[model samples]
Target: MTIRAYRDADLGAVIDLWRACDLIRPWNPPAHDIAFCRSSGHGELFVAEAEGRIVGTVMAGHDGHRGWIYYVGVDPARRRDGLGTALMAHAESWLARQGVLKVQLLIRETNTAVAAFYERLGYAVEPRLVMAKRLDRGDGQKNA
Candidate 1:
């Protein structure tokens, strides 16, 4: 499989891959997330293509100091093939080019497997909690 930047025509397949990997949730609409990433210019979205199909995806960004990774998913059928790692390495390289100092990713506490994946990639779990506030409620306006 080859890793590359996401394309406009890959939306449907990317969404389907996310769904197949059980990465979609009600609160975070995939389409809206994609649109935001594309327009906000805060990060890059990447995909892994195999046999002319999207088999994995990852979104990465940097805010000057540190880099963040999100929406990382590999097709269930293609998990052991290292596509996920390749995607992440690509992200790290991109972020490094942007002068980012550190890279981090958040995995649900219950998702031990995912945590392990990053651990294998030289990421260690920090003694910090992830806090968030929903700024958008999907109506093209910020939440009050």
Candidate 2:
């Protein structure tokens, strides 16, 4: 598989891969998340291709002091072949190139199965409370 930056045409395939990998959540609309990542120059969406098919994707970006990764997915048929690891390496390289000093990512509370994969990549479980407020609904309107 080959890893590279995302292109406009890859949107559908990427979204499909994410869904197949159980990455989509009702509260987090994929369309809006994709737009937020693509609109700002700080983020990048990387995709993996093999046999001319998109099989994996990772979105990485920096908030100046730290880099964040989201939407990591690999085709179910393509998992266990090191594709996920390679995609992560690519994302880390992209962040490092931008001078990001640290990297972080959030895994859903119920998705504990992926913790081992991340742990193999040297990411440890951190003790911190992740608080959030509704900026708006999925429609992109500001909360009143």
Off by over 4 Å in 2: 137-144
* Candidate 1 wrongly placed segments (more than 4 Å): 137-144
Clashes (backbone N, CA, C under 3 Å), per candidate, total 0, 0
| Candidate lDDT (C-alpha), each | 0.86, 0.88
Encode model 1's per-residue lDDT on 1-144: one tens digit a residue: 888888899999999999998888887888888887778776889999989999999999877678999999999988877888899999999888888889988887567777878988999988995666565555555322
Query: Once model 2 is optimally superposed onto the true structure by TM-score, how far is the C-alpha of residue 115 displaced, in angstroms?
Result: 0.8
Per-prediction TM-score, please?
0.89, 0.91
Query: Judged by lDDT against the true structure, how good is candidate 2?
Result: 0.88
Residue lDDT tens for model 2, 1-144: 789888888878888898899898777788778778879889989999999999999999988788999989999998899999999999999999999988999987788889999999999999998776575556665322
lDDT of 1 at 22: 82
lDDT of 1 at 36: 79
